[model samples]
Target: MTTLFELFSRQHVYMQEESAPGFAPACLMRVNPDDWGRIAEAARTENCRWVAAWGEDRGDELSVNACFEKEGAYAIARTGVPRAKPVLPSHSPYYAAADRPERHIRDMFGIAFTGHPDTRRWTRHQAWKEGEHPLRREFPADGHPPVPTAPDEHYPFLHAQGGGVYEIPVGPVHAGIIEPGHFRFQAVGETILNLEERLGYTHKGIEKIAEGRDAMALARLAGRVSGDSTVAHAWAACQAMEKAAGMEIPERAEFLRAIMAERERIANHLGDIGAICNDVSFTFAFYQFGRLREVWQRVNHEAYGHRFMMDCIIPGGVTSDMGDQVTVAMEKQITFLRTELEGLYNIIDDLPSLEDRLDTTGYLNPDTARAFGALGYVGRASGMAFDVRKDSPYAPYNRFSMEVPVYQQGDVATRVKVRAEEILASCFLMEKLIDELPAGQIRRDWRIPPSGAEGLGFTEGFRGEIMTYVRFGDNGRIARFFPRDPSWLTWPTLEKCIRDNIVPDFPVCNKSINGSYSGHDL
Candidate 1:
């Protein structure tokens, strides 16, 4: 496999002599503004995945950063432009995944993307005026006491014009307690011709509010990015902070973090499996999985302090240690869960009615999956064989073996099967973590890093790869923080997968993907 440096060097792109401070198995390059698109084109030629892109507002200029990964190696390319007329060529032309993120950067930082296909506002909507960019330093965190804005009914959505095509507009608000996002569909009869999503209704200005916070405060904030992925988010943020501070946590702490992450993965997979079943009217599997999830979460509460295991991962390490009694309880619970899941899976796999509904619904071809760089089970189900734990191991994961379940069917049934297999894989890993529990301090003392320290962190969340970038400002406060959730990549693929499927099958297709609204909105 080619290294990141070799790939860039072969393309004749200039690399900085001194790399950025805190990335491992990854490097940072400060490229000229003119070389930005060239760098993206080079990565695309190498079949690298475009991970994320965001902008930082300096006093006089704006800096844009984009990350790419190839063969377990990561490279961050950054460039700056004048704040007065912040314009940079778009990378979206090379990578489809960069489309919405670049639009988001334009909306948040007032940095224009030259040659971007769709220049309409993404995260902005009607939240702020056209000229106002909330992420700039001059903008207040409270947004000038926040006035109520009128409804955004005039935003243009793509229209399909044909003999029989008509529109179906779904929620920015819905009947359920889920977050707000609008889905616009153009359909002929029951078959969908096209689908477009309008998200960011739950935009919380997370990046703006993250400024100036200390490490601990930031950890707490990261945990709330998506309530369901609390453990994964917190672990990624803390890993970034710890790297910037140049601190090495205890071995025991690493194991504890992995254990919590695996448990979080299992709980979410169980819940998602149940939700998918419910969408297909498979009430038996739905209730069974729901009961299993409740029991799993209760076990989390008994061992950790929270049902979601929030606030348990701090900067230096984790907050709590697992005692012998807690380990015993967890091990016993794992055994019970595994046996029960086997029975449930056997019944669901044999049910012909459930099979008929899910067999080929919501098909996402492998080519589309690769083009969008989808992640987690969504990508795995469609035969994208990239998993952070096995491909880019870290800490406790590096110490043990991992199995990533992948399938090529790319349908609702395949997605459900991937999740089921992953639950079993997580169970195996959690058992190893418990069996090899180390004895030491759970956390170390956190130290303040010098100003201008930068760090990048990556964790394979239950959904997929979670990448976080952090740069420390004066007095060890956060200068810039960006956490790229896996949902950012998966949400767009949902639109592609739903095409040509019936409108009524949308629910199961959606549940099978299960993109997190808050995770993507942030």
Candidate 2:
């Protein structure tokens, strides 16, 4: 396989070695603002997936970053644009995943993407005045208190014109307890012509809060990025911090970390399975799966003092250890849950009515999935075979066997089947992890590196690959923090999959993709 350095070097980027240890184990380069799009297109043509793109406000220039991955290798192409004229060529024309983040960067840093297709504001939507980038160094975290926020009813949505087309607008608020997001659908009768999503309703200014935070404080904040994804997000943040400081955690802690991630994965898959079933009016299946999920969460609570395994994963190491009895009990619980889950899945799979509802509903083709760089179950169901655990192993994953389930139907049924298969795979992984549970200390002290330390953390959470970037300031405080959640990419595909599908079936389709509103909004 060709290396990342070879790919970028071929594109005439000025290659540079990053001094911060363990940030991203790949070649780094600084590119000219004009060649940013060219360099990005080269990597995309070479089959590299788009990871993330963001902008940092330097005093004199804006640092624009486009992160890409291929063959388990990552490359970061950054360029410094003069602050007075903050303009960079857009990477979105080649990578659809770059579209939202580029708009986000434009909204947050006032850096214009010269050739970006969509120049509309994304993250800021009237919260801040025109041309005021909240992420800039000059913008105070606690800005002057403003007047009551005005209602945003006049968003210019792209309306479809047809013989019988009509518009159906859904939530910035919902009847359910789930988070807020607005959806605009153009449909004729029940057939949808187009679906547009208006997210960022749950935007919490997470990156803004990370400014000047100590390591521990940042960890706490990262853990809450999405409550269900606490373990994965916190782990990614800690990995970045530890790597920057050149700290190595213990083997036992690594094993426990794996256990926490797997548990988090299993819990979410369980809940998602039930939620998906419930959306189809399969009430019995929902109840049964709900019971199984409740039992599974209770086990996590008994084992780690929290149902979702939140805050159990700390920076440098895990906060708790599994005693011998607890280990044995967890092993048994895994077997029981797996068997029960299989039985529950068999019922859903065998039921023709359930199958009819999900089989071809919300089909996302392989071509679309490829173009969007979809991740997690959404990508897997559509035949995209990139899994962070197997593709780019870290900790216990590199030391064990991994099986990533892939399906080609790109339908709701396929998505459901993939989740079912992943639940089984996670069970096997957990058993192996417990069987080889290493014996050693669980905590390590990480020293603060000098100012300007930077690091990157990449991991496969339940939803999919999560990448976090961290750079430190003086006194070990966080300077720049960005969490590129899988939801960021997956949310876009939700619109594509629903195309040409009936409006009423949108709920099941929505549940199948199940993008995290909070994670993406942040």
Candidate 3:
């Protein structure tokens, strides 16, 4: 396979000699706005995955950056357009995953992707005036006071017009305590023909609020990007910051961080498996898994001081450390979890009715999974074998062996099975990390780098890959920060997977995917 750098060099794309500062192995290059589409096309031809795209508001022009990955190497391509008329060709033609992100950029920074098939307003659904862009430097971090705006009743949703096709609109406000997102489904009788999602309702302007925050403050904010994935997001952001500052944390901190991440992965998978079962009315599995999760999190609080492990990871290193007793307890919990999980799995496998409900429902083909660049269990269940820990090992991961579970069925059963397998794999990793606990300092004094330095960081969150980009300005403050949660990619795939399934089965299909609404909204 051709390397990322060579692939772009073959296209005669002008790349900067000095690579961007990041823990992740990547290079930065400048591309002309006119050549953006060509660059994207080249990447697609080489089978490179589109990572993320975001816009920065420079003083005179709007700068757009697109990231791609191939063979464990990353390429970040940048281009600028005049701020007055921020128009450029779209990459959505080459990578279907780029469609919504480009629309998000257009919504936040007023950049126009001229050839985009859908010019609909994505993130900005009457949140601001017609001409106001929140991410621009001129826009205030604290916006003007709230004003009464009309309901989004006029927004256009695609109509599936036929003899018996009718539309069913689900909630922007749900009955349970969950973030709001509107889902429109066109169905003929009980089977869904198409599903479209409108999902900016939970937007909190996280990107705008991140400007000028000190290193510590920014790390806290990154932890909250999506509450459930706190450890992964904070680590990604801190990795970016530490790399930009040319700082390496102590070896002991690295081990502790990995332990937290694996525990987080296990806890979330347990909750998700239980929730998916509950959606299908398998209450026994739901209650059992929920009980296990509650105990797991309670142990987390006993060991790490926070049930969710929030604010435990800071810029230089982790804020919390484990003692000898805590390590022993954690090891014991891992053993207990494994034994219980195996017994539960055997019981679940024996149930023919449960198997009947899950066998072929909500199938997502590998082709669609690849086209959308899906991640985590969503992609793994569909036969995409990309895992950051195994593919691009970092720190503690580099020191240990990793195993990734993959399935080709791409159905609800396959997805559930993948999660169960991952939980076991994480238990194995946690055992290794705890047994090899190092004796050393957990953190080092932070050193500030020069202004205008940029870095990128990524980690495999429970849902999938989490990528963060950070640029430091004068006074060591964050000039620009963007966190690409895995949900952004997985959410679109959910819409595709739900088609042809009966409306009653939609809950199970959706619970199987479990894309984060807050993470995507940001």
CA-lDDT, candidates in order: 0.91, 0.87, 0.90
Instruction: Point to the candidate with the largest lDDT.
Output: 1
Q: List the pairs of residues colliding in candidate 1.
A: none
- Give lDDT tens digits, candidate 1, residues 330-420: 9999999999999999998999999999999999999999989999999999999899898888898999878899999999999999999
Best of the two (2, 3) by lDDT: 3
- The lDDT of model 3 is 0.90
User: What is the lDDT, from 0 to 100, of the residue 369 in candidate 3?
Assistant: 94
**Which residue window of length 10 is worst by lDDT in model 2?**
13-22
TM-score, one value per model: 0.99, 0.98, 0.98
Stronger candidate by TM-score (1 vs 2)? 1
User: Model 1 Cα displacement at 116 (Å)?
Assistant: 0.9
- Give the range where candidate 3 is weakest over 10 consecutive residues by summed lDDT: 15-24
Give the distance in Å from residue 108's predicted Cα in candidate 1 to where it truly belongs.
Answer: 0.7
Residue lDDT tens for model 3, 1-522: 656768977877665534566634787778888888888988998899998999998789999999998867788889999997889999999899999999999988999997899988998887688788899999998776488654677789999898999999999899899889999999999999999999988898899899999899999999999999999999999999999998899999999998899889999999999988888889999999999999999989998899999998998999888988898888888889989999999988888989988989999999999998999999999998899898888898998778899989999999999999999999988888888889999998888878987778889999999999998888998899999999989899988999999998999999888989899888
Candidate closer to the true structure by lDDT (higher is better), 1 or 2: 1
- Relative to the true structure, candidate 3 has a C-alpha RMSD (angstroms) of 1.2
lDDT of 2 by residue, 218-256 (tens): 888988998989999999999989888888899999999
